[model samples]
Target: MADKQDKSQTKPTSLQATIAGGFAGLLCIAPLDVVKINMQLQTNRLEGLKWAKRGIVHQTKGIYKEFGARGFWRGNASAQWLYLFYGGSQFFAYDQIKRALAKTDLSSESKHFISGAVAGTFATVTTYPFDILRTRFAAQSKDRVYTSVLDGFQKMAKAEGFRGLYTGLAPSIVSILPQAGLMFVGYEALAPVFKELNLPFGAGDFLAGAVASGAAKTAVFPLDLIRKRLQVQGPARSKLAYGAIPEYKRNMFAAGRAILQNEGPRGLYRGLVIGVLKAAPTASLYFWFNARALEILVQNEIFA
Candidate 1:
């Protein structure tokens, strides 16, 4: 029975299973992200929860009226690539880092937090462009102004120069550290408690992951807002609108100052509610699926 149990545990822990679960979770929240971005970029009188609620209503109305509910998934195709690279790399790096840290005497919480931060930072660096692209796609309307990701990239490059690809990189990187640290730390702290209580891993993982994601996202939401504003704002509208992109224009503080002056501190946290809404489901699904996948892999004798 011990041998059989070991083989069963091994079945769900394969690397591929974990990756697939991550991707699936990301895909699940693509529509919510689209709605969230639309709310963020609204220029009319609507603002905050009022704006977000209205936006969701408008989007739902439009989808029902026009595309028959399928419109909500407008950017899903591009999002798949975003998820594949960003989600896969994040989990892959996170798992690897955790494994390495497990060899040390550090507390599980410490290892999990540090490993998550490192993994998030590394994944962000590698896949920031795809993230930018995903946002662009999500922010588009059914009218199809940009056409495709390549077109958006080309237009951004031509309009703003090569630097456009990394418009919001600074705040994005800063936000990742705390957000990811809290997430993993929370997950690690809760996992054992769940096990002790003899609950299913999926339920425990989702609840733990959701709480962790919400906390982390809330903590760093201001920075995330700044990053999104920078990424989505046009070059013609930014302080960098000097007709020529400068090599020394990579200062996040300066950019933040400009944003504050132009849009106020409240602008720094635009769409926070939507962000939390999107993140909760995304993170919950990821941990739930990933835990289940890991269980399956462990059971299959794939990663014992």
Candidate 2:
């Protein structure tokens, strides 16, 4: 084991490992993502939105009944692209920035937060178009406005200018900056706790990812909801959206105020419950795959 550790320490850490984990996590949680988006976009206080109040099980059944098995994976393609770019860029930047900060006197938490916030901003801005496409694809109903991610991109850009693709970017950055920081902090902190418990191989990584994801997600869920809402705005709102689509017109505060006034604080957290649940396996698989893939790469000296 000592020899193995020394050999592993000598191998280069590959960003590809993080990308692979993101892909795996996306596949595992795609269906839940679809449900979560639908829930987030809905408003129970609005007319014709009473159905939105139904529990997750009912929502899941409704979606399956209407769109069949395919419904649950509406935006999976775009999501795959988003996760690939976001995860790779985020982790790569985080690793680089963290290393640079290691020589500083900043607390570990400060380093993690700064690194994560910067990484999240970089990744979110770079891959944000994919995220918008994913939201539109998932939030739409049977009367699909955008046939596919590429189609959605072309149509949205044509109709609303290229700038339309980045609607909600401000709120996304605001939320994700802290969200990303918290996720790293949670994962770094929780992993050691789980390790101390002497769980099975990779179990610590999995739990750390899950717990970290849940905590961070909860912290920024309202902003996430706002971002999703804004993504589906413009020409498609009247035609293809699922529930009461409030036109915030890029104003996150208006969106928040509207949701608060209309549905109380509960509206802001429309999909929080399901989101947290999904985060469990989603984050677990992501980090586990990351850790395991890094191990394999080191053992094989693949990226060295």
Candidate 3:
């Protein structure tokens, strides 16, 4: 194990590692992504139950049947543009920002939290349009909605004005700040305890990520639900309506209020199950790959 670790500790720059992490993450999480979007796009409780009845296995099979095995990657192209730059910038920003704040005398936890949030916000805003397009394509039926990502952008712009491309900016940015911030803080803060108890850092990261994603996800799931719902808004798929959820289609707060009033608190967490299942691993590998990559960079004095 030690020899393997030593040998593996010479990969690439931190920027490269972050990019690789994003690409690798998209692969690991794509199926879960399909499941997650299907779950999120459920406009009502009954619609959600339809998915529950269908099950992950069946839905996955349906995806394959619809667009073939590659259907699982329906949004891969747009996702690449989003995740690649988002991932690289997020990590790089976190490191640079944290370093900049090193002399500030804030608590270590506070610094970590702030760094992660800033990084997340930076990444999210820059590549946000790709995010909207990715979700739209992911939620699309085999009908091949919007043709391509660029096509989707063009259609959205023509339909809803330029603002069409950024359906969930406000809620996403707000949610990401706390979500990413606390997640990183939790993961970093847990390191010493894990080391004291002799746990592997990677294992600790995976567990911490689960806890972080679960907590953050639950808190902001309504916002996330809003984001997903908003992303798939303007282009009404002529083929599928899921349900007549016209009450909350206009804006975030109204949508949130409608869900809480109609579906109660549980409405916000429509896809909590698959979401966390996807999120935990996503965050875990994000940190694990980053740690390994940074180790290599440091060893090579590239990060020195």
Best by lDDT: 2
Count clashes in each candidate, considering only residues at least 3 apart in sequence or on different chains: 22, 0, 0
For residues 13-65, write the lDDT of model 1, one tens digit per residue: 33755465455546568667766665555433333324233546664464446
Off by over 4 Å in 1: 8-25, 43-71, 157-162, 196-201, 234-251, 302-304
lDDT per model, in order? 0.68, 0.81, 0.72
lDDT of 2 by residue, 1-304 (tens): 9988797776345454554545553545799989998888887534565445687987888788878999998988999898877777777777778878989999988998898889889889989999999988887778878888889889999998988989999899999999989888888889989989888786998889898989999999999988888888888887655546866757889878887987899889888999889877787787777777767767776655
lDDT of 3 at 48: 45
- Model 2 alpha-carbon drift over 4 Å, by segment: 1-3, 14-28
Cand. 2 TM to true fold = 0.93
| TM-score (all chains, Cα) for each model | 0.80, 0.93, 0.82
Give the top-scoring candidate (TM-score): 2
